[model samples]
Target: MPQSSPRLIGVGGGKGGVGKSIVALTIARVLSDRGDEVVLADLDLGAANLHTYLGIHGRVPTLSDFIAGGMADLSPLLVDTPMPRVHLIAGGVGSLKTANPTFQSKMKLLRHISRLSADWVVLDLGAGVHYNTLDFFNAAHYRVVVTQPEAGAVLNAYGFIKSALLRRISRVFSKDKNLTKALEERVSTTRSRGLLTFCLTDRLSMSPILRGLMMNTGRD
Candidate 1:
């Protein structure tokens, strides 16, 4: 039988206090309870507090260690959580540099994450629409956007989605500078009017890959 690839689920939001980590943890627990080995990664970088939510105190080896070359393999940094079948790689607290890791470092981490020996890998991304955050969110097989009932939360959530879409478009057409420029102009004009003011048909016609990005949004 052919081996199945590990599932990558990224949970993110536009801002803090939106229950992003809570959702990620809940999903991890559910998966682990089903007998799947799960790795819950706190990818927030700058202000990581997932450990606090999990009731983990004191310092633990984090992504910073791996990024700083303190560890060769990420497995060593995987602190065993109290939950069965669930392990965690805590995020670096106040690691501002990690907020904007180099492309090479991002690629290295993503590669290691893909190769992790687990049934599911849940990445809890930081709030905001920073390029780094969006890149990680896009890397996942499934992406979930968390939001609240407040108007501000809703607006921020919209901004986050628009930013992700624009970033994806830019990346897809990066080689074609003129085409990318045109897309950016269109996105800007549309955003000035309203969220999702652009035509869905046009975006869908651009590329199957992009269409997939729009439609593949998973629930948290």
Candidate 2:
């Protein structure tokens, strides 16, 4: 039988200073305590700082090396953390382009993440609705959005979830330019009306492609 892929968990949020990294670290530590090998990836790009939380002060290879073509695969970038059974793939602190990776580089990273040998892979995604961050968060089997108790934090969290959902929906209809345009227009209009869910449901009913996606999502 073929080897099973690791379970991916992404921790993300819309706003900064919401403690996404802490939540991701705690999840990794808890899983490690249970004897599971965990690979915690800091996908925070330009602002990568998970190593500080783990007490790793030395310089190490990061996802930047892999994205920049300096490294062949993510395995070489893995650094052992203080937590037993929990390793880290540090984030890059390179140029602006490295912080905002292209679509192809993002896809390559996601592919390698799926192939990691660990039992669980926890991704600490950067805050905001950047395409790269949204894609990484959606790639995970389990998605977690962190937030604080303040009104701004709650609103940002809601926005993050909404953006992630829209991004996923757009990808599903990417092959159909007409449908994608229609979906974008509907989102913009419905968002202003505060009728996003109902409006999207109505639009989905009109498109066979969207209907199929809804059915598949229900099954999943």
TM-score of each: 0.83, 0.82
Give Cα distance to truth, residue 203, candidate 2, Å.
Answer: 25
Best by lDDT: 2
lDDT by residue (143-178, candidate 2, tens digit) is 666788789987887788778877987999999989
lDDT of 1: 0.79
Tens-digit lDDT track of model 1 for 34-70:
6889899999987888888888899788888888875
Model 2, global lDDT: 0.81
Candidate 2: misplaced stretches above 4 Å? 185-220
RMSD of each: 5.7, 8.3
